[model samples]
Target: MNEQLEFVVRAAAIGTGATAVMDLWGLFLKRTLAIPPLDYAWVGRWIGHFPRGRFAHANIAQAPRIRGETPVGWVAHYTIGIVFAALLMAVWGLDWARDPTLLPALVVGMSTVVAPFFIMQPAFGAGIAASKTHNPSTARLRGLITHLSFGVGLYAAALFSAHLFPI
Candidate 1:
């Protein structure tokens, strides 16, 4: 494969793996502590309203439901993951993927919280960093932990890719 194509493939794989890891972490939390995972359907609803010129909501839960929201949300979730992975590679270079390291992955992963804190959360009507939620601190903590897990996933996925591809 050509260099750019190989990079794209690798980024997609790494991002998917990282997103899966994040989901697994959510599942673990839910199973062990009864903590519910994020309902991506809300994300879909938010995105679904895009064409209607609706961006921000006071309470996304109160927003009207969109058709195929669940699928759209899930796809957006994974696509975001892939974009983040591609960003990591872009900043650190493909060499980082070949010789994977924890710090860079973690940095990129954790930093992704910026999106939800500023963009997604606000647009979802949760306020910045989920401040409008019932419990902002807990919400923030959960988000941090989730993002941290994604960071770990990035490292793990990169390591796995290196082992599997060896190129």
Candidate 2:
């Protein structure tokens, strides 16, 4: 394979693996803290409306339901994870994946919070950084923690990859 292509392949693997780690963390939080996991169905509903000319919602729960929204949401969730992983590779380079450092992975992971804070939140009607939610500050804090976890996930995935591939 070409050098760039090899990088992309490795990046995809790392990103997807990292996302899986993040998801496991989410499950742990839900079980330990009694916090309900995110309902990707809402994310699907939000995305489903795009073609119909809707972009933002006052409350996603109030939005019309979409068929197969759960599956769609899950797909989006994992896909987003892969994208984040790819982004980590892009910024830190494939060498990071080979060596598996901490700061770079964590930094990239935390920075991903912007997507939910500004894009996903506002689009879902929660406002920027979840400002429109009933408890905006709490919501924001949770989001930060979640993103930080993702950063940790990135590190874990990279470490695992290094162990497995050992290139």
Candidate 3:
């Protein structure tokens, strides 16, 4: 495969794998600790209104439901994962993907917290980093753990890919 095509494929796989790991972690948290997972429908609802210049909501749950909100949110979630993976590749390069390091993946994953802290949470009416939510600390911890898991996922995916396509 061409260099660009290979990179694209690797990035997609890494992101998808990372997202899957995050989802699995979410499921574990939900099942073991009774922690609830994020509502993607709300995310969709928030995004759905962006075209209407309605970025902030007092309560996304109460926001008017939008058509195909669930699908939109899910797609956006996965796409964001891809973007993060691409970011990791951009910073660390294909050599890292082949060798599989932990720090860069973790850093990129943890850095992704900025997205929710500044944009997503605030727009969804949860305040920055879910400050306005029922339990801010708990919410923050959950996010931190989730993001960390995504970082591990990124590394794991890289290792797995390298094994599969060893030079």
Candidate 4:
């Protein structure tokens, strides 16, 4: 396959893998830990509560239910994953996508938690660095673990795809 096509395939694989991992994490958190599934609709309602400060950061737990559309939030979530994968490729090359190491990939993936803690969560009104949650430490830890799993998923998917395609 051409290099461009290869890149696209690898990036998509990474993104899909990350999404799957995240979904599994959500499921486990809900089923095992009794945490509710993250609802983008609720998040939308929360954002809508403050029309003037729609984009401003606040504590999501305290913010009113989201009221507007949810597609933007969902898109942002997946796009972040895709961007992470692309960055990995840029740093380590296409070969890394096929055989991603745990250290670098996990590190990169975990690093992504900062964005949600400081940016998206706050923008959604979660709080700066998870300050709104009753148990911020646990939430932060869960986020880290989940993102690490996503990195592992990316590696596993790349390996499987490589096996299927054989370079």
Candidate 5:
């Protein structure tokens, strides 16, 4: 395989594996922690409403419960993983996929929290940088921890895939 195509393959593999890990994590969190599953479909619906500005800057946390759905949010969540994988490939090349590094990936994932803090949360009415809650600092810290965990997930997935399906 050509270098470029190989890179794409590696990136796709990493992205897929990382997304799977995240999905499993969500399920585990729901089941073990008793955190209600966030209906990703509802998140998607909210995304659909973006064009109309119906959900624009709407406080999602305060929104009345509607089966606890959010398809757009789920889509966004997975898409972010895909995008992050692509970025990792772009910056580090296929070798990174084969021999994933936890630190760099963790840094990248943790840094990504800024987006949800500044953009998504506020748009969904959570408040700027998680300001809506009684303890905004705790919320922000949780988000950072979650994203860092995602980074670890990404690295673990890549390593597992590389071993299971050697390139």
Candidate 6:
């Protein structure tokens, strides 16, 4: 494969793997601790409002439901994961994907917390880093844990990707 194609394949594989790992972690939390996973439908609803010139919501739950929001949110979620994987490649280069290191993956994974904390949370009316949530500290911690899992996932996935899509 051409270098560009190889890059794209690796990015998509790594990102998808990382995101799946994150989701599995979320599932573990829910099953073991009774912690609930994030409702991606909200993400879909939030994005659905964009076409209507709506950006931020006082409470996304109260926002009008969008058709197919569940699927939309899921697609967006995975796509975001893919984008982040691409970011990992962009920052560390394709060589990282080939070598599959931990630090860089962890760094990028953990850093992804900024998206929900600053952008997604605020837009969802959850406030910065979930500051406005019912329990801000708990929310923050959960987010941190989730992102850390993603980081770990990035590393694991990169390793798998290296094997699956060898350079």
Q: For each candidate, what is the lDDT?
A: 0.95, 0.83, 0.90, 0.71, 0.70, 0.94
Candidates' TM-scores? Answer: 0.98, 0.93, 0.96, 0.80, 0.79, 0.98
Please, what are the lDDT tens digits per residue for candidate 3 over residues 1-167? 77788788889999999998998999998999898889888888888999999999998999999999999999989999988998899889988887888999999989988898889999888999999989999889889989999999999988998898775
Task: Score residue 90 of candidate 1 by CA lDDT.
Answer: 97
Which run of 10 residues does model 4 get worst, by summed lDDT? 60-69
RMSD vs true structure, all candidates: 0.6, 1.4, 0.9, 3.1, 3.2, 0.6
Report the Cα lDDT for candidate 1.
Answer: 0.95
Sorting all predicted structures by lDDT, with the top scorer first, yields 1, 6, 3, 2, 4, 5
lDDT of 2: 0.83
Could you give candidate 5's per-residue lDDT for residues 1-167 as a string of tens digits? Answer: 67777666766767666767666766777799875444565566557665565765465544544443464566576777778888876777777777778876777677778877887777777788879867899778767766776777778877885786576
The candidate, 2 or 3, that scores higher on TM-score is 3
- Residue-level lDDT for 64 in candidate 2: 94
Question: How much is the lDDT of residue 20 in candidate 1?
Answer: 97
Over 4 Å off, model 1: none
Evaluated at residue 126, the lDDT of candidate 2 is 89
**What lDDT tens digits, residue by residue, belong to model 6 across residues 64-124?**
9999999999999999999999999999999999998899998999999999999999999
Error of 5 at 132 (Å): 0.8
Candidate 5 Cα lDDT to native? 0.70
93-141, model 4: which lDDT tens digit per residue? 9887766676777777777778778876677666777678788897788
Stretches of candidate 6 off by over 4 Å are: none
lDDT of 2 by residue, 2-90 (tens): 66875777676777777777778779988999876578899899889989999899899899998888899888987888788888888
Error of 1 at 20 (Å): 0.1
